[model samples]
Target: MKENVALIGWIATVMTGVVAPALILALIWKTPDTLLRTGEAGQFVSATASVGGFFSSDITTVQSTTGSIAVYNTFSAPRNQLLVVRETLKNGLQLCAENKPDTCVGLAGSWAGDMKPVPHARHRFAGLVTGIGNSGASLWLLIGILVSVGATGILAQHVDREGRRRS
Candidate 1:
């Protein structure tokens, strides 16, 4: 019985350390290309102009970096109206805007909003915007794997002690 318990524990430990991490990396690798997208929309404004009014529609993109969401306005041209951008993350929110008059160039809006910083919400796998959620899931999976490996190591030691005591 002790031998069986020890073997089971050892298998679990090895699975966590070896199989788990590999599975995570594999999932990340298998993640589709659309998971990462780049285009003019996501680029920084070359210059600033005046926006007529508050923009109702906003452009957003997911970056390669985990937990980072890029948001921007289609009105790239700067206008007199100040374009307030906000980004909400898991921790908190961030604010940024394109001040008028001067060209609002080089403003890569990711995870930022106009009013309040867009709160970072867990990504949903189902829907049109799966990339962001998929990335988030992948990140969480990796973290879980790491935690599992650590726990496995600690449990392995306990199992070994029990095995020794029984013998």
Candidate 2:
């Protein structure tokens, strides 16, 4: 019985400490930093999460009081929230995604954002945010480490019992 328990412990240690991590690394090795694909229910093709918790770009968010503006949260990460400008330009200003005749205000501006990060925030609204506010890689790594600790504890309990018997 003691031998069997020790063998199980060694097996668990090897599996948790080596094999499992190696498998995870292999699975993620070929994964791309950015992905774009449509959803199953006739959704738009979008760039998937980039490395870390941020997207491949930092989307800017703006708020104005003199007029109404559209709200769009591009990168859904923590630190993804960049410049939040609430300008009150006197001109009947309109910020468009594109430049065309009489479309976007051709005025001097700054703080157009793009480029990804590990994320440190979410959309100001509650419904737009999800997950534990961390990257999947970090979550998985944490899980793996926790499981490994549990396995080690199990092995240690049995080994301690066996040692007491010897003494």
Candidate 3:
């Protein structure tokens, strides 16, 4: 029974020390590689400054205002560009707006975005923007590291406590 408890503790320690961090990294990695690659290559634009043609009809805005935008190669329409933008509005409203004629409406907030070249697709590019106020890859990496370290510390403390109790 004693041996079993120790083994369980060790297993927990190992999992917390290794598995937790590995899982976080895997989750981040599992996201479509193309999306990450595209953001790295795409241009960063500011929506407030550059975006024009301001039109909104009860625009469903949200406090967090997080969203994603991506451009994908259209296999059916090889000659045309497909731009996709997904946003979380402030409220439940269908407000439509676009940039002014010939004007480039920048992305809103501190959005992390990227652009990548599509393979086998002529003159086509793909990109994504995480959305407003997202901390981006660097921040997520930092968070993962911090959480792993914290978990390890907590496990170490638990082991120490158990050791003291046994002795």
Candidate 4:
């Protein structure tokens, strides 16, 4: 009976895990391209941009190293945004310089928003974009909640004891 109960709980968790995100995406996104939209409209779209210098004071935003230029919001958390942008730049280097030499430098490009940041951090960051729209800025918040809930439930099932152990 206890095993049955555990099984049911696991199934419930799994169902909720899947259904909740689906429902949220359906209601929030409301379109097929929603996930791919950029800058407040949808998930961060991938683009190529020039490499600006890094900052020790505020790593969340990458400023243009040279002349007054656009700053990328990064849309990353305070903790890992630097690294995420670094990797993205690494990939972009390969894609733009190696893959397509013609578009290596100059000109405006799009950037994919990364949401992997420290959950406890209490900062909301923005980046430079081609243009701004009125899309909700809380999409990252929603994705974070879904991931946290799903992970917590899974951890509970694994760590939970079915009954008291016999001596």
- For each candidate in the order shown, give its overall lDDT on alpha carbons: 0.42, 0.38, 0.35, 0.33
- Ten residues in a row with the worst lDDT in model 1? 33-42
Summarize candidate 2's per-residue lDDT along 40-82 as a digit string, tens digits: 1111222232232354333333332222223232322222122
Residues 1-167, model 4: lDDT tens digits: 65666567666664555554455444434322111111111222233234446652211222321122223332221221111121121112111222233322221334444334333433121221211111222454455457667766765665475343421
Q: Which candidate, 3 or 4, has the higher TM-score?
A: 3
* TM-score per candidate: 0.32, 0.34, 0.28, 0.25
After TM-score superposition, the amount by which residue 122's alpha carbon in candidate 3 deviates from its true location, in angstroms, is: 8.7
Ranking by lDDT: 1, 2, 3, 4
Q: How close is candidate 1 to the true structure, as a TM-score?
A: 0.32
- lDDT, candidate 4, equals 0.33
Query: 1 or 3: which has the higher TM-score?
Result: 1
Off by over 4 Å in 1: 1-134
Query: 1 or 2, which is superior by TM-score?
Result: 2
List of clashing residue pairs for candidate 2: 57-115, 58-115, 78-120, 78-121, 79-119, 79-120, 79-121
lDDT of 1 by residue, 1-167 (tens): 75567567667765755565566446545544231211222323333233334744344432321232343343333323234332222212222333332322223433332243224444322222433334455565676667677766766787788878879
- Model 3 segments more than 4 A misplaced: 1-106, 109-135
Number of backbone collisions per candidate: 21, 7, 17, 7
Off by over 4 Å in 2: 13-18, 32-35, 38-134
lDDT per residue (tens digit) for residues 1-167 in model 3: 65457557666655655565555445444433221112221122312112224462121121112333322111111111222222321111111122211222223333353334334332111112323122243454566556667655766777788789999
